[model samples]
Target: MQDAPRTVTFGPKRFCFGRRTYVMGVLNVTRDSFSDGGRYLAFDRAVARAEEMVEEGADIIDVGAESARLEAEKLDPAAELERLLPVIEWIARHLEVAISVDTYKSVVAEAVLQAGAHIINDISGLHEDPEMAGVVARHGAGLVVMHLQGSARQPARQPRYDDVVAEVTAYLQASIQTARQAGVAPDRIMVDPGIGVGKLTEHNLALLRELPRLKALGHPILVGHSRTSVIGNLVDAPIGDRLEGTLGATAALVALGVDVVRVHDVRANVRAARVADAILRGWTPPWPWAFDAVTGEQRRPLRSLRELARQD
Candidate 1:
């Protein structure tokens, strides 16, 4: 089958895939993010975490003021602004990487975009407020349209699939059209498969495996399975111990050509992506590594080239 169309032609940044995996580090400024709750609630702590991610080679930083886990309540507009405004400014002033604000509220989206955020990573996909489309369009910011099952309260009921993959592709396609109709440009959009919100375990796995299928919708895909119970179940590990599983999934996702990885352990995922990217970077080495038949030994490496030649 033909692969889906792809473009990262958003404003100020063009996200071409296969050059390398783009790592989006998680920075939850709230006290209730399901996985890393309370860890970075303090402003200084959050900023420190963002700095750490940057040092660890994060390509983007995603700041969220509310946890979308379960019936997680939405942050009131004023509090949301109070929490993220300085964080956005701090990152903009200090880090050279892109910043994606994770909010579905129009108010929060507008405020952060004004405060120097480059993208609006909405989990609701413009379903929550019609005005969100306008805010994004006005600022000319990039958006992530995720396939959520439902709001945290309403929640997606079950796998109502006449083929979940096809349905999701259609939904995202229509969403892109909807945003465009409402004035958001096509190039400024990205689609996400909405991993855990309402998908069954099997449904989530299927979406992860077939993420490329969603490409037919014609936008970049951001796969976020980091520290989610999805990885936990895959390895039969608990939340705190799923680091290996998370990195493993990230490895597979990059190999499959997914565009961006939203992750918790930014440094580790960066390593997995770097290795996977070396193989997928479109040029083969003159020869494969030699293998010994006596003990099936592989002569891999004791040394490697570490940095890219500086780009002018």
Candidate 2:
């Protein structure tokens, strides 16, 4: 792990990590995503959902054209471009948030960056497409180099790590070196531990427990644990009922100093993150009137205490 710049600029947006945790809303435009697959396949529906997430306080809209499910079929570059171009163009034209194209194919990544996306979230960590790193570097897009143990086309094999944290840390360190070699600025890079991609429940838990260890790499850490099987297995709850579990885990991650959280339920997770961020980084009232009582006048509780101290 090497020290890198703490801030990254994407288009007009700059993400200054360590100040607060940024929430990235998931916008899957695929028909077979593990969760919420067909919900936003239509252009109108996808645009509307993106708008809803922006309103719900999403700092980035992660647009995925194909599912990353273990058993899912791989999408051709042309097919992926067709599914993602419209949504990415629309979001870029209509929204004020950063746009992250969740892809690993260099062609797909190049197309999306040309269509106005600001980030390329490569789950393969620059290993899948030989040209992925160059595409991101040429476009100067923010890159998310995630650590996955197996190829994306195949089902994830059960991970066999003697020490999950150490191995993951080493993988990311090497991946970061790869990205830097390909001309990606260190500040433009973020790393994901690939929580449920190739790990068992215990491995996932261990990664979460020692997430801060990855900070040694000096790139911002992005965790996407939303409604993963890790939580489902623990609570014996299905995907639909995992909201509380997701919030619980997100709150813990924020306290642990994670830089970004990718989630499905944007509104609920945004509120949970804000509260947790307030606890980890002290809260500042959004407005002075937030302290005002029901009366028309501003309450002066502290002033009253000062008067009492004078009498004493």
Candidate 3:
């Protein structure tokens, strides 16, 4: 795996990686997102949810107009713009957080970037729409190129991979090359493994277990596994009850040095990332904790060392 990037510029904001993991809150404005569908379909609710996420510690807001579920119906560019433009405009005008629109259509990406969005999270890895790469390049927006075995609009097919990690790495490498050829800068690109999109449970597990291999691509890795079927399969819990499972996954990703995690439960995931970052990334209390700068040990203890030894 390549050394962590020093910094990445997403539109007007700059994010320094290797300090701590960043959380991206998911805001699906569609009525069929498989998890939070219809929850933010209303304009007021969607805007409010974005505000809440920002206050809850989300470094980015990922807005999706169309659902990516295999069984979900397709949404035309016009209809998608109708649902997306207003929200993107509102977030751009009101919110201070970075805005990322989840759409594979060039028309939609163009419109959203014009509407003040900073990033485009394309599930097709710039392969779905012929004009997507150029649009992203023109806007100079941050791009996330995700790997999907089958088309996002196509019906679910059995995913076949002899070596999931090697194949995914190669697929993403090709995507990065495509972006660079289209004039998109390397620092503006991030890669996703497309967990639960076209992969079976075992495939998803393998990707997660071998995520370190993705870092070798020399791009920050972004994983969106919140409340996914993989979590449900592991914990045997329903969508609403997967909070603990999602946090568990977040901690693991933090340990693996993931740069960004796109999640539905922003507050819980942010808190989990904090603890994991503290343990794995050498983070300590910010202030008022009387910690040793060189040793990272607390100078003042709640219980005296003598008392602790007596208990032992």
Cα lDDT, all candidates? 0.78, 0.85, 0.87
Candidate 3 lDDT over 243-265, as tens digits, reads: 99999999999998898999999
lDDT of 1 by residue, 1-312 (tens): 223334454323446554556788999988778888889889899999998887776777899988887756667889989989999999888866689999889988989998999999988777777788889999988898887767633567664666778877777877788789878878778788888777888888888888878867766678899988788888998889999999999888877777889999988998788777777654232444456758778876422211121110
Off by over 4 Å in 2: 1-5, 283-286, 289-312
**TM-score to native of every candidate shown:** 0.86, 0.90, 0.90
For candidate 2, write residues 1-312 as lDDT tens digits: 222326667765577688678889999998888878889989999999998887777888999987878767689999999989999999899877899999989999988999999999988888788889998999988999898887867636777889999998998898899899999998899999998888999999999999879988888999999999998998899988999999999999888888899999988887798788777776433433324466667554433211221221
Best by lDDT: 3
Ranking by lDDT: 3, 2, 1
Question: What's the distance in Å from true for residue 92, model 2?
Answer: 0.5
Q: Which ranges of candidate 1 are over 4 A from the true structure?
A: 1-14, 152-154, 157-159, 283-312
